[model samples]
Target: MSVFVTVVLFLVLAVAVNADIEVDCGHTEVKVRWSDPRSQMEPSLLKLGTCSPNSFYDGKAVFNVNLEDCSFRRMVTGGQVIFLNDLTHIYDPAFSQPVVCAFERHSDWSPPLYTPKFNTYGYSNLVFQMGLMNADFTGPALSSAYPLGSLIPIMAAVYQSSHQPLLLHMEECFAAMTPQPQPDSPVYPIITNKGCLVDSKSTNSRFQTRERTSEMHLLLQAFKFPLGEDVYIHCKLMAWDPEGLDSSKKACHFVKGHGWELLDDPARSDLCRCCDSHCMARRKRGLASGQGVMQKTVLGPLTIIDGSTP
Candidate 1:
């Protein structure tokens, strides 16, 4: 009977001590220790700190921990990560705020971190087919036609690469135009102000990524410009990392794309003119038109911040 009781107690103790454990690589508020075979044998070991010398090059850090473990796979597949045993807490105050985690795939080169990238293909029409005009007109006459009170849709889509998800918090966005007589000319006359016609309008507000990318669209019906003049269109966007907004580093990303296509009649220059305000509106209404996704550009590359780790 004593032996039976001892066996029961041992089983209970084993069950209590050896159980599957989860460590959220994305976010962890609790203390954790490494459960790998080596770390398990030496619970006190901390492995080498990720801050050790030569840890990062070209914005990517080589973490000493093996990412092939099931826990890592779980983290990539699912936001919440579960490890085999108690493990040392993984935390990088700079990167752990809201817990943004992403892994490298065999596909394209993954940026050091997950970031927003613009969809240039969707913007083709907005940049190329914005206006219709003849190429031969040269004098003071306007080469393009326009109807009053026309509205143009300016739009873009953004997505995070691979399967990693991201939540976007928009900060600011605007559309501007520069009118020039010739595409090669260095000087340009301003025809529109910031934000195009909706200077006070807000954007998508906020959005999260899924199997696909998120998008933003704007109706530009608020501009007063000379009819028949050719112009260049440019859009600039900025989004903030909600958790890192106050950081002095690159806490936000800026994306930009331009729409400028020279007509076949205009000597094939690189300038696209806007249709008369009312003309574009009637065209869309007539069609009842339905429509409707990159090299990842990093803000760090342009900013003074050195993303490389020492």
Candidate 2:
């Protein structure tokens, strides 16, 4: 009788422990953990599966959610669903086709973090495609709505890579509901780096004038971002001429990159070396001429902050 009682108590404790689930979001990954008392010895049993004929646990079941599906927008509290179709106005045709996942409870959606309203001098066309752990999404199982608890991690990874600011346009969004930074507050810091330029010109007889010119290379990096929170990096470029003549105007260009992309490829070794080199060379020559030709540029990194499991 004592042995029977002990077994009952053990079963009860196991069930209690298995009911809780914890999710962790990292710079480049998301992890979901849960306990299952029914098959404590076989963790795989808790994974998504279908029930078999005449079996209690063998029925057709889906675990992941499609990020694009209307159902997902309804499930998430105060979540706003932005489809590729809606982004075409601000993005190019190539970008118009990529998938995007956005959730905000704010009354008004802010311009893109890197790309802001044109008058605001920010990049306005950055977008993201939904996938699983940087892998291609093959079906509904891998969609953002899937129950894999992987979304947070994936978001964190993207933020870590791009460091581009994430604007929580929704006031009541999950991140905003918590005591963390408010949607309108600038809680994170913006890092700045030096800009370089390159130029080639030849002196002419009876006439000396500068005509054709190009910009030099510029690079910037940012770090230490909160998980699941929006982040942004802003980069701008300014230039001047050899005769100590600054351009009558400054040309501003912005590129939108994500933290997850940075975390996924932190080394940034995948950048186009050939194009970068040309840009850098231009900056170097412009500076060497001592003619006053210089360029100033900025890069913005943004993402949201969230917690991770130890």
Judging by TM-score against the true structure, name the best candidate.
1
lDDT of 2 by residue, 1-310 (tens): 3522111100111111123333332221223343434422333223311111121222221123222221111112343423211111122233211222333434443322232111111111222221112222112222121111222211110111332232111000111211223567544322111211111011110111112222111111212345434333222333333232111222112233421111112244232222223222232233334322221111112243322432
Report model 2's TM-score to 2 decimal places. Answer: 0.21
Q: Model 1 off-target regions past 4 Å?
A: 1-146, 167-213, 239-310
TM-score of each model, paired residue for residue: 0.23, 0.21
lDDT of 1 by residue, 1-310 (tens): 3522111100101122223222233221212222334222322222222112124333222223432211221222332222222223234223121112233232332112212221231122221111111222111112222233443333333543332222222222322222212454442221222112223222211111222223333333323443333223433332222222221111111112322222111232211223112112111111012211111111100011112322
Q: Give the CA lDDT, 0 to 100, for residue 191 in model 1.
A: 20
- Candidate 2 versus truth, CA RMSD in Å, comes to 22.4
lDDT of 1 at 26: 22
Count clashing pairs, candidate 1: 18
Off by over 4 Å in 2: 1-79, 82-184, 187-219, 242-310
